[model samples]
Target: METLYQQQARVFKALCDPKRLAILEQLRTGEKCACVLQQPLDLTQSGLSYHMKILCDSGLVESRQEGKWTHYRLSREGREAALDLLRQLTTPDAEAQSSGCACRRGRE
Candidate 1:
């Protein structure tokens, strides 16, 4: 099983690549086929597949195989989950806020 940190890292890892970011922008419009994505992104079939795999693994993108081509789209649930994770990680805990820092206690 993936640890919580590992799972969270997947999402960040996926966002780290420029190619993957472009792929995601294309997906935002709606579902797109792998073939349709090739030209705009300047990616060969194999290149597209490489990036798509990362995106899919991150859970930020989902895919469906239709006949020969794979269709890709932004996953609404995944998007929400990613956003929630970001908020949770960035937001300060109420208890921590109240406690302040031990180092600062002597000065105050």
Candidate 2:
């Protein structure tokens, strides 16, 4: 089984791409169709599809088909889960270590 760090890495890795981040910003307003996202974001349908796959797989984006077009939107539950993981990771450090996260240990 994957550890929690590995699980959260997938979502963070998905967000690390510029194209995916752009697509996510658009999604923050409301759900949008592929064609609607393509023009403004300057991404081809295939490109958008690829990013959508990553985002969807990250569990941060959800999709539905409307006729021939695919519409995408942010997944509220997934965002909550990711944020909760981050909170768990951060809160303990702020309490237990008091100095900082482990990586920063002896550096500061």
Candidate 3:
């Protein structure tokens, strides 16, 4: 059984790829049909589907089917988790820096 951190790591790894990150960025605007992503990214249908499957499995993206189309959007939980992970990764380094660190100012 995977721990929560392990699961989250898997999701982060999925996002670590540039193509997958681009897909998430597109989804941030709103939900979109698979074809929308395919066209903008200039990815083959099979390539797009493979990336989508990884995102879906990682729980970073959610999908719904409407008739013949499948739409996808980012999951709020996944977004929050990713943000929290990023914050955690940076906080320690920021803390070690000068007290006037920009990241610290935002936290205050």
Segments in model 3 whose C-alpha atoms lie over 4 Å from true places: 3-5, 88-108
Off by over 4 Å in 1: 97-108
Off by over 4 Å in 2: 1-4, 93-108
As for lDDT, the candidate ahead, 1 or 3, is 1
Q: Please write out the lDDT profile of model 1 over residues 3-106, one tens digit for every residue.
A: 99999998999999999999999888999999999999889999999999999998999999999999999998889999999999999888767566778887
Write the residue-wise lDDT of candidate 3 on 21-73 in tens digits.
Answer: 99989998999999899998999989999999989888789999999888999
**Deviation (Å) of 33 in candidate 1:** 0.5
The digit string of per-residue lDDT tens for model 2 on 1-108 reads 998778788888888999888989999999999999899878888888888998998889999999999999999998998788778767755445565577888676
Model 2 per-residue lDDT at 60: 94
Scored by Cα lDDT, where does model 2 land? 0.87
Model 2 TM-score is 0.76
- lDDT of each prediction vs. the true structure? 0.92, 0.87, 0.87
lDDT: worst 10-residue window of model 1: 94-103
TM-score of each: 0.86, 0.76, 0.70
